[model samples]
Target: MVPSAIVTLAVLPLTPNGKLDRNALPAPELASTSGYAAPRGQTETILASIFADVLGLDRVGIHDDFFAIGGHSLLATQVVARAQQELNVQLALRALFEASTVAGLAARLNSSTEIKVSPLLPASRQQPLPLSHGQERLWFVEQLGLSNGGYNVSAAVRLTGKLDVDALSAALSEVVRRHESLRTRFAGRGDSAVQLIDPPWPVVLSPEAVATEDAARQRLVALMQQPFDLAQDRLLRVALLQLSPDMHVLALSIHHIVSDGWSMGVLVGEIETLYAAFCAGRPSPLPELPIQYADYAVWQRRWLEETALQRQLEYWTVQLAGAPGSIELATDRPRPAVPSFRGAVHRLTVDQACTA
Candidate 1:
């Protein structure tokens, strides 16, 4: 198998002259991607090549999905632009969902199929209610940070057993109904922001499944590689992995807009509770959240504008002073004159003696 290359860049603070002052940035190491490879010769290949050119993917394949490869919503727009230029087809901003795979998307294009428009919530579900104070606050904070692109953050977990699809479905539904953030969407009000309420509950499960471990890994990898709708309010994704007859893993991802690490913990605890209850043949109702993510956004804006934030910024400036231009590393490709955060990961294990 051909080895894939990985890239990393140190982000620096800008000086008054507008040049990157690399000396002020932290030295982040380049991550590795030895086992991971992009799919080749599929519709994904065309898209991936475009993405690689724009985002600088060291290695990409046709079967590779965008999100699994660390593609975000900001990058999704870029992909759409490339598609328009290369394919000469008009794609809606949301086309990534129906035509996620290269083969899947290429088929759509070949057949001249129309892209379907999806609603914030499916019509079968109940309409969502208004946003709470907490949800409002979360939105404000995201806007302030200029990190309002992606709607969900996700992770993968391994599990053990033959998954009962019926039970898993019920548990997912319960989690969605219990959390308001899962159902909330943001509307732009002229120059301001508005939080539109909708019932966004219950996880949507894909019908596709693989029968073997290798096939399961390939499916999961492909799913992760594809980009999802992040500009929308609900940005959570979950995948179940059946590694063996008795071993399974769960991949949980949520958009940062509706959740933080703290909120994720809350979601996990609730999911566990609901899942256990379902397994026992009696599931209880989930208590309402004190507030939604939007409320936190509003609160964050107010907090950041206060004297406390001024002091915090001052501390950060001092703490990050005189760092370095960039972290030096051996790479598969020549370094770009300007650094970027094209990163990959490596796993390490230590022996007992090393631990000691």
Candidate 2:
């Protein structure tokens, strides 16, 4: 069933003051205590309770899909972590995709099953690492009591001709090895602070080809539909698409923790140069980046301490003065006490007539 049928909800973006307009939420629905073959009432009640507690939602129904109401990848990881701690159930990171609804997930839990966890990098590479500038920023925002929004930065490059998949993959691997940000991690510094460190890059490649235009479009849709994982690994991901025998596209999605808009340009430029060099059988000519994202994080901490943060705070305060109390967006139903980041996404395109 579609998510709307279960719990219709949308998250209203927070205003500068960082408060939600509770009145904008839709009313909660009552739990369906009958009809299904499963232990509907018990399962629903248990799952709803978990959802309410974990997501900070007021009420949750059994039929509601965790993600449909605006669940995010990182949040999904938290949910899994909580489940392991509270329910003593080990859940695969991918389980949320299949068991989106509370009832569905509870049923899966009821059914004894095993999920294989992916192996980590080599022992030599397994060490505490540092956080990226973006990660530091996220941590800083959270420390300031801001809602954890899914901060992401990415780039899309249009390919001119047919792409050599094997060559591109090799080039990507080389790029990963060269860039420390793509290979970095966050380590805890006493209290709530974190330090950034360089770690071995572990890259996973998934490639596919589309024979027709419709197929290519479908592939793109599916790619976007797939949620990014922010819990197990760094948030950076890449997808290379074979649109046709003569055209292709490269899409990169990275959590805001590692990079920003300027950083994206830097990454794309480096990748293009490296790919071209690899294709021509020449060494990559790109100059070394003086500092990786981690260095920037360290620098940011130092910089913010130099009275600059006060000025920034003053600027923002005045800029947002007298602004609306909250940025309210309509939702289909009442929000849960504990909010889940899961949500459905729809794509729209314009044709010649529609555009013109």
Best by TM-score: 2
The numbered model that scores best in lDDT is 2
Write down the worst ten-residue block by lDDT for model 1: 116-125
What is the per-residue lDDT of model 2 for residues 158-266, given as tens digits with 9 covering 90 to 100? 6877576666776677777777667554444664444444455645555557677687666655554444343345556788777666777787776566667887887
Q: How many angstroms is residue 124 displaced in model 2 relative to the true structure, after the best TM-score fit?
A: 19
For all predicted structures, in order, the TM-scores are 0.44, 0.47
Model 1 lDDT per residue over 1-356, tens place: 32222345554488889998767765332232234445444455677577567556576555455555556677778888778767756566677666654555666766766332221222212333333345455556565543433334555556566666567777878777766567656665554455565674666554454587678777766655444443363556777766555677677766665677787777777777777788888856576666555555454544456424676688789998998869889899997654454669897899999899
Residue ranges of candidate 2 with Cα displaced over 4 Å? 1-134, 137-149, 158-160, 187-206, 211-231, 306-356
Taking the candidates one at a time, how many backbone clashes does each contain? Answer: 57, 27
Candidate 2: C-alpha lDDT: 0.62
